[model samples]
Target: MSTPAPEDCGYPSPRPRLSVEELPAAENTQPIRSLEDLAAGTFESDQELEEFLAFTCAERRRDVA
Candidate 1:
């Protein structure tokens, strides 16, 4: 399936930019063990969402300075 544009993601603005540091702090990250956890009304906050997106988008990109 094709990935939807950021605008289609339902943000107030289209293609919003997010800072890497703006992602949720690792200490506060929650464990997503199962789909049931998501269906149970968890996964709060946009920061967590951004973190997950970043992980998916940059997973193969090495951390180069």
Candidate 2:
């Protein structure tokens, strides 16, 4: 079996990829202070926990960049 090319896979390729230098800087971005806050067990429900995890992932990604 052969793998399909990006175009043959039936999804549109992202157009005009921008380099890091081409992207504009965000003025108000803030670093997350603590992952410990997510582990504090204060969430009342599973949905809250999922949202917090998602937020943590985004924060970590921003911090790395």
Candidate 3:
């Protein structure tokens, strides 16, 4: 038994965006092992990163406060 989604959920229905056969093969799509590795990339601008950090920090504050 599953709940019905609202008619106006304001989002598309959850469906596969891509089929497994249609996906590209990944040669080196792996997780970074250390903070140093992540720090090596160049960001186009700091605004996007700053906004994400601020949003996450606010979420943590709300959870704890």
- Count of clashes, each model: 0, 0, 0
Query: Model 3 off-target regions past 4 Å?
Result: 1-44
Best by lDDT: 2
Better TM-score candidate (2, 3): 2
Q: C-alpha displacement of 45 in model 2, angstroms?
A: 0.6
Q: After superposition, how far is residue 21 of candidate 2 from its true place, in Å?
A: 58
Mind giving the per-residue lDDT tens digits that candidate 2 earns over 1-65?
A: 99887888888876776666555443344446788745767889999999999999999999999
Expressed as tens digits, the lDDT of each residue in 1-65 for candidate 3 is 97668545766677656655455433334557878867845655799779888999999999998
Clash pairs, candidate 3, are none
- Across residues 1-45, which tens digit of lDDT does each residue of candidate 1 receive? 998776689865544455666554534666688887778544588
Mark the regions of model 2 whose C-alpha exceeds 4 Å error after superposition. Answer: 1-41
Worst 10 residues of 3 by lDDT: 21-30
Clashes in model 1: which pairs?
A: none
lDDT of 3: 0.70
TM-score of model number 3 = 0.35
Model 2 residue 34 CA deviation in Å: 26
